[model samples]
Target: MATMITDECINCGACEPECPNTAIYQGGVEYDGLDGAKHAALSNDFFYIVPEKCTECVGFFDHEACAAVCPVDCCVPDPNIPESEEVLMTRARQLHPEQAFPEDYPSRFKAGAAAPAASAAPAAAAAPAAPVAAAPAGGATFVQSPLDALADTVPALESWDVPLTCFRCRGEFEVPFQFIKPGTVLHCPHCAGSFVPNTILYRDVAKRVTKFYDSFTAGLDAIRSRHQAEIERFEDQLRQSLQKLKDDVKEASADAALAGAPQKNRGFFG
Candidate 1:
């Protein structure tokens, strides 16, 4: 099993140098593979592990060096990504081809502790990703990781701001996705006039937002069956990314807050 770091990490940098494979990295920092290729940081806030380079200390130590050194015990086996001793040893051999590993190399697996069905991650889970938010350990709340990619998938998901134009003053402004709803009112900053954003453009934007939310939810589901640990971390990022889209629909739909539509401007209001 590949070890992963959870959000419980204190950024103490305890696990960075412990890996024999040199797979550990600081949050927000990019990782440089031996092949001279540069990938974006897997995490921007806490320390992270590169599953590609993680052999669970096979052929090197009887236990995971990172887990041994972590102060907070954030390092743990990734159940979502199960790996057998053979696969781990093979990875160790490939990573350090100079050294020869005996068939009975030191490993965390007692025997065939895990099954290797896919290469680290499945094709859907292995698509090239951009830097995205990395979730901490556990299914707990999400913290920010700058452009960090985790959970073996898409880099951090991006955020979108809704644009609006005041009907009365014709002044343009933007609304957050969370605040956009059927009955939400767009108040003109320039003239203090207000109107309901139920126009054709508003409907179009709402549709796109719905589509985005739908696809994103689907992507999150795709992140499953990869690695249990990675799934948690991936969920961290997914929740953190959607934090802004918090269902403020109830608040936004309370059109009574505006009392009634514009009495004069009549902009986009019914």
Candidate 2:
């Protein structure tokens, strides 16, 4: 289980920079994974998270880093998905174990295990599914939406929770967004736009962006490789031509020398 962002996010660009795992991203941007294998497109409607890379601050902070600084208190615990403190710590260690921890740093969970269940009060399970894949190095780049007053985008999260839906295609999907701010547009993976009123259509936008991003990147690589190969071939041809010219000049010089060689006189005409 991991943390999620709700639709209340104001797109202030505050939480985007504070994320530790670089899991947070702007709605429309794409991120490359640390594995150097895949890329993920972000939604344009609201701030998003990458679940695969989110350790929920288990390894580093006693509490969540993003939640600490979010002015709106939107970075609350995700109720739907829950994990023990131990599990969160393990996840954190796995994400960034290279850092050194203080000798007396306290762990929130049981000794070498996940935190105990909180008296069986219907524990939270897992974090919402992220929209994009993890990147190779610095992960995703979050682009905060320009602030403009629009109709409130958030719902009464304290009451009924809303599900992520494709605005255009009417498809039900999973995209982790918290209700931190307003006027934050959620991006559609297929339709190439944000879902106004949060519907199924925007999923199409998201999908299309992903496809285009991948194809465009692949095409760029292909073109670059072809150009390099062509340049190399041309250089090789030029070298060969230069060598041929040199050989021809040498041959002509040799021929001239032979032709100019004075005929040997029968006797010794000095």
Index of the highest-TM-score prediction: 1
My TM-score estimates for the predictions, one after another, are 0.41, 0.37
- lDDT value, residue 241 of candidate 1: 68
Q: Kindly list the per-residue Cα lDDT of model 1 for residues 149-250, writing each as its tens digit.
A: 333343222334677777777888876655655687767777889767665766687566654444443344333322355768999999986875565665
Tens digit per residue, CA lDDT, model 2, 1-270: 566666555555666666778888887778656575557565678777766666666665555666554433345556677767567666656667796656544443426633321222221222322223233467557443221111123222222233565757876654433331244566666665675442343344444333433333333333445557788999999999999999999998876747568866788657
Best by lDDT: 1
lDDT of each: 0.66, 0.54
Q: What stretches of model 1 exceed 4 Å from their correct place?
A: 111-270
Alpha-carbon error at 74 in model 2, in Å? 2.0
